[model samples]
Structures are given as C-alpha cells and as structure tokens.
Target: MEVLGHRGSRVPGPENTVEAVDAALRAGADGVEIDVRRSADGDLVCVHDARLSRPAGRAIVRQPTEALRARGIPLLDEILDVWAGRGRLICEIKNQPGQPDFDAPRERTARALAERLRARGWTGPRPTVADLDAGAGGITVSSFDWFAIEAL
Candidate 1:
C-alpha cells in the first residue's frame, strides 16, 4: 500500500519539477511518478508536455536542455540526484507517436533511459521492498509506446 504521488503532488511546486518531488517526499509520499522526455541536445528532461505552450510556445524537442532549464524544466539527472536513495521513482517515458519527440522503431528514448539507469548502478534484477528500505531505492520505467517498453 505504498502511496505514490502523481507528478510529485503538483501542489508544492510545478508538476515534474525537482521541487515538487522533494515536497512530495517531505509530505510523506512513499514515491513519485514523473514524466521524462528528451531535449534537442539529447539530455533527458522532466516535462509532461511535448511543447512549452505557456512560456515558450515551442516544441520541447526543438529546445536544448539549457533553454528548457531556463524555463524551469528540471533535468532527469537533477531529479535523480535530489531523490537518490530516498524513495521509489516511476519515470513515464513520453514517446507517443503523435508527440513532437516521438521515436519509432529506433526507440532512442528507451535506449537512452536504459543507459542512464545502468550508469546509475541499476543493474540485475529489480530491487525488492527490503532493498528499497535499505536505501537502494526503486525505479520503474513505463511508456505508452509499446516499442519503447520492448526496447528497454
């Protein structure tokens, strides 16, 4: 019965931001769900929309991570660094076909995600609850794109 916060509660700060994730944890959430997308420079960023409609009015795929960060979009690494060994993290890769950053058969998003997790020492079998309680934490990757999931 772990309580997971949707987009890090979306109350203390903007959804998908590092601030929100921290706030959710402080509020006693067992874990958090966040959206992941790749920027033009290939950096994984935390953002739900394909486009920054309100502030930038441009597709996220067209903007480099620096530009996106200037607009308050947190990088995936930033979130991971802040929340490492803290709790569970469910990262929903945004690679839908209709989206601007969609990756088809190549599934670059999934590949990159795998590489990132591997670099973080997330190898072998999935971590158990005891592992999480012991500060190893936990991670779950999901996506609407079946191909992406298969690629992972």
Candidate 2:
C-alpha cells in the first residue's frame, strides 16, 4: 500500500505547511501530498488556500518571500530542501479562484516549481520536472481546473 499522509495529518500541524510535512515524515509516511499556489511575487508556496490569512489570520497574498519568511511558514523550496531526497512530494496545484490575472499565475507556478527542482539538481537527475513533454520525471501535476492541466 502507498502510505501517504492526509495533508500531513492535519490534526498535528497546519495543513499543507512544512510543519505538517515534517510530522508526516516522522510518522513514517512514504509520501506526502502538498497543495501548491503562486504567491504574490510569483514564487511557489506550499499552501491550500490562495490566501494564507484565511486560517492563521495573516494576510500573505502578494507578499514577497522575505516578508513571508519572517512569518515562519516555509516556502516550497524550504520544505523540499529538507525532504527532497527523503521521500516523495506529491505537488497538487491549486486553482486560482480569484486573481487579478490568470495565465501569469499558472506560468509563475510552473516556473517556480522548475526553479526548485533545478536548485537541488533534481530536475535532471531525480523526481522533479516529471510533467515536461512526456515530459517525464518524478513530480506529479494535478488540478481540478482543465485550463491548468492544458497549460501543462
């Protein structure tokens, strides 16, 4: 059986946050499914809702990485840096329900993801960049929006 964490067992930590990812790894899960979103600066963030303030009451949309870093919520890169080679990160892209622009967010999300993979050299050697042109790798790209899927 594939032992995947349910939003990193949300009861123990914030759903889709790095704390949850760590909790899942400690719990011996073989894989983790994380929701991805494009932050204000076009960087990828591991979060479910478009607005981070929804649950924590902290407005995070359109905030740059440095400002977000001070909030303690790790970015996509920070999370992967810790567990990139330990197990699998099932990245599920989130639908941008309300946004100023559409295509920009999607492309930014993709590029941010690609950058993460490239940073750790996982794009060429490992499970990252799985959705490129056959485009095969280890990453999994999924979404409820048909437009997003078609974009990939």
Candidate 3:
C-alpha cells in the first residue's frame, strides 16, 4: 500500500501550498493528495474551498489565479511540474452540493483537467501501484460529484 499525504501533509505550512507538499515528500510521504478548483480565469488552483472567507472574503471562482497565489494559493500545474518524476499525485476535484459554482456546466472543469493531465501524458484507466514510484505514476482525478465522474 502507498502512504499518500493528505493535502500535502497537515503538518508544515498551509494545507495545500507548494511548501506543504514539498515538506510532505521530505517527511517520507510516498505521494500527496491535493485539491483542485478553477479560478475566475479558468486556471486550475490548489485549494480545498469554493470560497475563502478570511483573507479573500470571496468565492474562489470569483478570484483569479494570480490574486489567489499572492494570498498563498498554488496552481495545479506548479505542483504537477514538481511532482512529475519525484512522487505521485492524487488530485481531488472539489465540488460541494448546493454551492453556486458546483452545479451544471461542469464540462469546462472536466476539460481543463483532461488537458492538464494529457499535457503530462497521463491517460488510460485507473492505476494500481504497489508504491507511489511504480509505473508511469501521474495524477489521478477524483471527485464527489457524480456528474463530474460521468462527464470525465
């Protein structure tokens, strides 16, 4: 079994930041499971919330990638680049029921995810790995949204 870190380890730094992810790897995590969400400009960002209440005081979809990054949010691509050959990545797409942006018209989200994964040459069905470093270990996208599952 693989020992993956949750949100890049809940120990050092913020939950989903690049710093935290790197720390997880250093601390002996085989891989990291991070959250994925779309920003206002359609860029994929690493964050667990559909909205940030304290710092941004706004919805995540309403903010751009740059602004969120300035506030400490990291982009999905950044994580991918770093983890490409070093470790595995499990991407959990965030979708909450009753949320405004979590409803229909999710094709864009699916497409964006596909594009990013494809860029990294990650395709085919789900992988079964004995360890995180086994095989062509790329990112895996999972979500609670049934529609998203169907769409993807």
Candidate 4:
C-alpha cells in the first residue's frame, strides 16, 4: 500500500509548507496530498481553507502570495519545486462556496495549474490520480466541487 501524507504530515511543521513535505518524506511517505487555492494575484497557493482564518484574517482568494507567505502559507510552485519527480502529488483544489463568480475561481485555478505544469515541462495529456499514484511524475488534481473538476 502507498502511504500518502496529508498536507505533508502536518506535525513537525505547518500543513503544506516545504518543511512539512520534507518531514513526511523523511518519515517514509510515498507521496503527499495538498490543497491548492488561487490567491488574489492569480497565483496558486497551497492551503486548505477558503478563508485565511487560521493563517490570517483575510480570504485566501483576496490575499496575494507575498501576503500569504508572510503568514506562513506555501505557494504551489514552492511545494512542487521541493517534491517534483520525487513523489506523487494529490492536489485537491479548494471550492469557493458562497462566493460570487465561483466559476471564475475554478477557471483561474485551472489556468494557473496548467501553466505551471507546462512550464515544468509536462507536455503530455493531463493524467489522473490513478496514473500519478501508479508512478506518473507529476500531479493529479481532485476536488470536492464536481463543477470545478468538470471545469478543468
């Protein structure tokens, strides 16, 4: 059985941070499951909540990457830089409930994710979680919001 870490084990350090990812890998995790949300500046952030209640008092969609980083949030690229090709990534795209322009967020997130993957040299067709979990070298996107998944 593959041992996938939740937010990179989330113990020795904050969830989704580079440190937590390293910790999980050191502890024998084959891969990690992380939450991804788009920030105000259209950058992808690795976080679980829509609102930054724990990290800050602002909404994640309204906070830029710089601001989120100041509050200890990790950018998706940062995590990818650390784990790319080393382990599997189960990326859970966060949903925007009760937010106006819900579809916009999904679109932006998908675009950013696609751009990042392409920039990282992924030229093949998008792969599924089963593919990545079966040893594909990139990421697999998932979401609680079926609409978001469908939009991708």
The top-ranked prediction according to TM-score is: 1
**In model 3, where is the ten-residue run with the lowest total lDDT?**
129-138
Off by over 4 Å in 3: 125-136
- Predicted candidate 3 versus true structure: per-residue lDDT over 55-82, tens digit per residue: 6458888887888998889998888876
- The whole-model C-alpha lDDT of candidate 2 against the native structure comes to 0.64
Q: Which stretches of candidate 2 lie over 4 Å from their true place?
A: 54-60, 97-101, 104-106, 124-137, 150-152
For residue 13, model 1's alpha carbon misses the true position, in angstroms, by 1.1
- Estimate, for each residue in 1-152, the C-alpha lDDT of model 1 and write its tens digit: 78888999778779998899999988988889999999999989999999998665688988988999999999999999878857899999999988889988898878988999899887569888688777566889999999998998
Error of 1 at 11 (Å): 2.5
In terms of TM-score, how similar is model 4 to the real structure?
0.83
Q: Which window of 10 residues has the lowest lDDT sum in candidate 4? A: 97-106
Ranking by TM-score: 1, 3, 4, 2
Q: What lDDT does the true structure give each of the candidates?
A: 0.88, 0.64, 0.78, 0.78
**Per-residue lDDT value at 46 in model 3:** 93
Number of the predicted model whose lDDT against the real structure is largest: 1
Off by over 4 Å in 1: 55-57, 129-136
Model 1 pairs whose backbones collide: none
Q: After superposition, how far is residue 73 of candidate 4 from its true place, in Å?
A: 0.6
The TM-score of predicted model 3 comes to 0.86
